[model samples]
Target: MIGFLNIIVIICIIVFALSMLGMVYRVIKGPTLHDRVITLDAFGVTLMGMMSLVSIVLDTTYLLSVIMLIGMIGFIGTVGFAKFLEKGVIIENDRDNNS
Candidate 1:
């Protein structure tokens, strides 16, 4: 039943929202930077899922593209943040003596 499926989707989206609320708390009062980073990653993933669920609810596929783009950006950001947190740098310096 299409109606039943829609209900299931709606429930999933609601759950996603509730999870993000907890993540937001972690983001605001986390004791460490790593905890904040984890919360951010969770929040981003939840947003991407919410975008997909919205597209489904609206019977349109346009939001799918946006979802993918946002997901990729989130992944890249997480990687860069982790690298910086670990080593204090993202890109390595080119050591050359020529000036």
Candidate 2:
């Protein structure tokens, strides 16, 4: 049972590494702003997966807190970026536009 889990973990790690390369390619060769955003998000997702894999392999939950923190940070960042693209800023300065 442990051996099977190890194999699965190894496979997941390899997939994550490949995903990182794909995300890097998008980051470097993306021709559009949305593509760059996608790449950045993909990288973040991959990192979270990596953190989970590490948690499994090491048989400890010490890294889970860091993973959750990253998730919250990523969500906030994506929201900020989307708002910036839509309104040219994150924090609006007008009472009328506050929603």
Best by TM-score: 2
Instruction: Kindly list the per-residue Cα lDDT of model 2 for residues 1-99, writing each as its tens digit.
Output: 569988899899999998899889889999987778767877887899998998999999999999999888888888888888788889966887756
lDDT of each: 0.90, 0.86
Predicted structure with the largest lDDT when compared to the true one: 1
lDDT of 1 by residue, 1-99 (tens): 569879999999999989989999999999999989878988999999888898898899889889999999999999999999999999877567455
Clashes of 1: 0
Which consecutive 10 residues in model 1 have the weakest lDDT in total?
90-99
User: Distance (Å) between predicted and true CA of 53, model 1?
Assistant: 1.3
Which stretches of candidate 2 lie above 4 Å from their native place?
96-99
Q: List where candidate 1 sits over 4 angstroms from the true fold.
A: 95-99
Q: What is the C-alpha RMSD of each candidate to the true structure, in Å?
A: 2.8, 2.5
